[model samples]
Target: MAKKRKVVDAKRDKNGNITDVLLEGNKNFTSTEKALGMTKSGLIDLVVVKRKDKEHLRTRPDGKKGNNLDEMADD
Candidate 1:
């Protein structure tokens, strides 16, 4: 059997905050959050989307569905 190696997907900022995260490969922010039992505001930072990217990485809250950031920004 081949041994699987652990991957370091994210690195913390100098302030100890999660500066960046990798959605590809072995780890991601949300996965790490759930694993560490991190709830509330701490999780917000993990939820991110690239404005110029065509795909919406996350879904909007109830009643806010079908609206993109630009559409929502107008309100």
Candidate 2:
């Protein structure tokens, strides 16, 4: 059986170009492609990289502490 596709509520600006999209899927790609209106199988054709989106994933300002520890002077 095929997976159910969710009804995506896409957001657009005054120019009518799609800007933001909301869908139900993985924290990875399915939701992203759906929001971008790509075929479900299309996302699998290419590599989907999962990078840390500090702005979206960061819950606190010090989330980068571990990464910056070496570069930043200890206080």
Candidate 2 lDDT over residue span 1-75, tens digit each:
455343223344476433443334534322333433343344222123346851111112455554221222122
Report the backbone clash tally of model 1: 0
* Clash count for each candidate, listed in order shown: 0, 0
lDDT of each candidate versus the true structure: 0.35, 0.33
Once fitted onto the true fold, the runs of candidate 1 whose alpha carbons sit more than 4 angstroms away are 1-8, 25-75
Tally clashes: model 2: 0
Q: Write the per-residue lDDT of candidate 1 for residues 1-75, one digit (tens) a residue.
A: 223222224445456444333333434453434423222223322233446743122323446533432332231
Q: Report the error of model 1 at residue 60, Å.
A: 18
Residue 18's lDDT within candidate 2 is: 37
- Against the hidden reference, what TM-scores do the models get? 0.23, 0.29
Top TM-score model: 2
Kindly report which residue stretches of model 2 are placed more than 4 angstroms away from their true locations once superposed.
Answer: 1-4, 25-75
In model 2, state the lDDT of residue 58.
Answer: 13
- Quality of model 2 by C-alpha lDDT: 0.33
